[model samples]
Target chain A: MKKLLLAAALSALATGAAWADTVRLGTEGAYPPYNFINDKGEVDGFERELGDEICKRAALDCTWVTNEWDSIIPNLVSSNYDAIIAGMSVTAERDEVIDFTNEYIPPSPSGYVGLAGGSVDVAKGIIAAQINTIQAGHVASSGATLVEFASPDETVAAVKNGEADAVLADKDFLAPIVAESGGMLAFIADDVSIGGGVALGLRESDGELKAKMNTAIDAMKADGTLNTMLVKWFKDAAPQW
Target chain B: MFEICAEPRSLEGLTWLSCYLTTPKHAAMYYSILTVLGLLLAVVPPILFLGFAGALARRSKIAPVRWLGVGYTSIVRGVPDIVFFLFFPIALDQAVEYIRHKIKCADVLEPVYQGNDFVVCQAAKMPLGIADQFYHEAWGFSLAVITFAIVFGAFTANTLHGALNAVPKGQLETARAFGMSERQTFWRVHMPQMWVYALPGLSNLWMILIKATPLLFLLGVKDIVYWAKELGGMKTQVYTYAHPDWRIWYFGALLVFYLFLTWVSQRAFDRIFARASRGLSVAS
Candidate 1:
């Protein structure tokens, strides 16, 4: 125990850190391309790899914790974890509650997808969107009847079940489903951009930790690593910042 | 699982079925079901003990003690258990932090409950902001368990109190005629007779507790319901073992599991009731 305390002290002394003894990286661990748990029950995805790299470059000892997306930010304020590496986009509403590092992945607008030969109109039809998402916010004001689900996949299911005429989500999240559906579905309308790009969420009080993570993110963008990771995860649709 | 499960496309019929059932997430789901059973085993004994104390307290001669016991039983019985289960953990956590806030940051305190937010000082944070990841989970789970215990304990008290009254008055009178002390007669005769009456009610409580285990998911513990959603979602090629949405099948399996569990409990309770009421004239 004394040795463990010494190790913590030495790390704190090395980093000149003012926060905690160890960094806890929180993520939803359910959203794909950004964060998700592998079959091994460990977090594995773009955000997991990116978070590790950031932690390494920042010289911080980090651990990962999985939380549901709905209460992710509130839990952060409650001090359940130090940072959220989940795919949360930076929005003015969210910014009021928490700070974000500079965009890690640039703004990727959402698109509406529906069945082919269907009477769905993005402007007037019943739309399905994941609750608390930018797409949901867009639909709320689009003059379209909106149905919200807990997860992104549920919105797609809603479209398939004829519960809604279309679903609005990140094209990256929807593209695989559209392809896997064997030409049953197609994009109904153009993309709608809402919030700024995804970034690591941090407590507003942790300015020093935020600075450290921003430096790591900026370095990845400067090098080709960030783009490579985007291509590796999001494939051909990888957005260039 | 069949050896042919190595190729997802090559497999067909039962081979595919076997392979699909043995996925890591499926294994985790199985373990999560057992976690509910484990919680019942861990929680039931303490709940029963609390019930016994409350029952005895209700029978106490002292006015305040009897009032405490009566209030506990009545208040909990009057409300739904799930309401308490949902309400207590967050309320208790906030109550703890509020007390700590009052004690620790007594000087420069702003209003803690500000509009929609509960803004306590960093020092007043339960498990603290800097505590380890495991510490946070442990704190949340302990709160859940306490909530479960407090709610079930009240019901158990009510049942045990009823059983105490249902015990034949002649048994106590006989003990008194034999020159036995009040405490001795209550412990030796009344307690044994009370068990025969209590067995049916306690078994019913056990079944309800079994059903309530699934609510652990709502309290933030990664139980069976959480795993069902996680494993049953559609998996794209990005995942190691890609599959279409199979949530219906997963939840169907859970349905069968709960059916079997309740069946086993019913059979076990019948045997226990028969044994407890052996050589007794009670209509249990």
Candidate 2:
């Protein structure tokens, strides 16, 4: 009688755990054309749609949450969210800290886009970038102040203020900045590029959930949903997975 | 590399005229910095006042008031201000929602944090999930400004408190002997003298504030740093305006701008300092 009662209690606990179906999704709304808040104040863009599809495919109720680009990783580790669909590149270094889905998006090169103006000869010593960034690493390795700004707006603002010689950004993101910045900048050379593409991030402990996501993503790619979403957002610039 | 032209050439004389100073967007970023300046200038004073309150509370006579003040000041100081800067806006955002959540989503049976997500009913959404882009930006900016004030206010309080105390004890005693009330002494005798002592500390705080302005990026506010990173990246030949390797130039421009601002501020502070010290004859 005691053994039977103990088994009954264990079964109840397992049933309670199995009934949970909610999932939390994270994104860096800062990255546009991937995931950004629309004028409607709703999360929109390719990653946003893709995240929704994944939840639909997995049959889990999901909610979208936005976080800053810098703190997204730390927040993920703390279980601030269950999954991250931000335009996070799956770098080898980052892989050591968190497991990722098979590259949801393939490698895309990032480079600085500046207004056309006076040529700067920074080949031997000078590399273009703000005081912080992977690009800044290029300058710091060579030992320099590495120009710094507070935001994308300020970076372009520097050119308008005649305070900065150029600005750095992803090659794909330049068009919008150029359009919005009121001609303060134009295209610089695309010689130097940073190779990485956004991927879905998951905590390593959630192997079960990660496997589920991978399957859903694979199905999306197979069914042409991924391509369709990319074209809707990126037009011709949408990268292949 | 450092050579200069005798006259800043017009579009006619310069060889790279089309390449330089020609993009329509480039012309607009100039005015944008004014907006950035406006944000900094408009937001800082209120923060100072807030800091003053926090500091004064810590020095209060009532134990509870003193404890509250101590808590505010210490909480602001203990964590890295960056963490506070990032966390406060989101936490405050959630707090606003949570309050709304209780009123609008009173029926939510499950906990707010289920595993990792914070879910509130539609009625409880802060800014109502359907607000305009401008409203969201404004809300975000206001939150950033408040965070700035809360964090910096504590430091300002510490400075102001010390300044308030540094007024010689004899001055307070003399005021009392003259039959002036404590309030009157604080306003006339102490308040007036406190600035002279506070000037040095306040000026230092101001410099720190200037340095701290860059962290606005972390707050999700679209400040100048955001634009720099946006415009400084490399672009291909397909782009409207094409050049080669210009991020160093963009960043160099920023360095000069900050240096100029700092230099001008130093000059202004010097004038204020001299005026504040005018009536004193104490030996160094």
DockQ of each: 0.27, 0.05
TM-score, first chain, each model: 0.89, 0.78
**Where does candidate 1 stray beyond 4 Å?**
A1-20, A123-125, B1-23, B74-83, B90-140
Q: What is the TM-score of chain B alone in each candidate?
A: 0.85, 0.84
| Model 2: fraction of native contacts | 0.00
Q: Tens-digit lDDT track for model 1 on A134-208? A: 889999999999999887777888888899999998888788778778788888788888888999988777778
Give the worst 10-residue stretch by lDDT in candidate 2 chain B: B1-10
Tell me the docking grade of candidate 1: acceptable
| lDDT of each residue in A80-143, candidate 2, tens digit only | 5668897676667777777788667777666555556756544432334533345555555545
lDDT of 2 by residue, B194-254 (tens): 7777878888877777767767767656566554544454433323333444667777877
Best by DockQ: 1
Q: Considering every candidate listed, which one attains the maximal lDDT? A: 1
